[model samples]
Target: MFSTLNWFGWALLSALFAALTAIFAKLGVAQINSDLATLIRTAIVFVLLCLYVAGTRQWSNPLALSGHSWLFLGLSGLATGASWLCYFRALQLGNAAQVAPIDKFSLVLVVIFAVLFLGERPSLREWCGIALIAGGVMVLAFKEQG
Candidate 1:
């Protein structure tokens, strides 16, 4: 079913879901502890993912995973947890419009990390786009103080 869609299509869907997540999370976090909110969200995600893996019969034994895979995946989970905590706190303390854009500054960092760590070379056009995104994040994240 997904064969016809390319990476860009998937990325667009991700962007749509991410935008919805920000709006929904902002509303949900109101009048609650941000950390508790994040925990609830994480629990929901964990259950859903577990169901998905079970339904798909894609569960792999932990022992089957290589050490490198375990290490990297563990690190990724830690990073995700930290990111979610920070994102939820930011949402609680700020407007979704501002917080989401600042969170998206990750795009710039991803580009740089891809080049340096993954040895993936982006074209000059892509670099320009990255720079533009960074600039836009700065513009969106900062407001003039009266």
Candidate 2:
């Protein structure tokens, strides 16, 4: 599926999914605690991912990955777990409308990291997007005057 679109399209789709998640989670978390909510969501995702891999028979290709691949995959899992932990804590502390915008600010971090570590150069358009994202996060952090 990801093979079909360009990077811009993929980024847009990811942003849309993130926004949908924030909206749904904000509604759902109003009734349930974040830990329980995280557990339930993680369980559902685990089942779905397991079934998808099983259906695709990707489990049979274990030797295709190198040791370095496994190492990176493990690190990726750790990063994901940390992100989930912090995200739930943020949701518990504030409205998702506010939290989600701050979370979206990670793109600016990504831009910095990519330039430093990956030696990837962002185009002018991407810089514009990052600037707008930073501005949005600043606006989200401030209280609305009456």
Q: Mind giving the per-residue lDDT tens digits that candidate 1 earns over 1-146?
A: 56698999999989999999999999999989999999999999999999999998989898999999999999999999999999999999999989999999999999899989999999999999999999999899888799
Best by lDDT: 1
Model 2 CA deviation exceeding 4 Å by range:
1-9
The collision pairs in model 2 are none
Per-model CA lDDT versus the true structure: 0.96, 0.84
Model 1 regions more than 4 Å off = 1-3
Q: TM-score, each model? A: 0.94, 0.82
Quote the positional error of residue 12 for candidate 2 in Å. 3.3
Candidate 1: C-alpha RMSD after superposition: 1.3
- Give the clashing residue pairs of candidate 1, or none: none
- Tens digits of per-residue lDDT for model 2, 63-107: 778999999898988887778767876887788878987887888
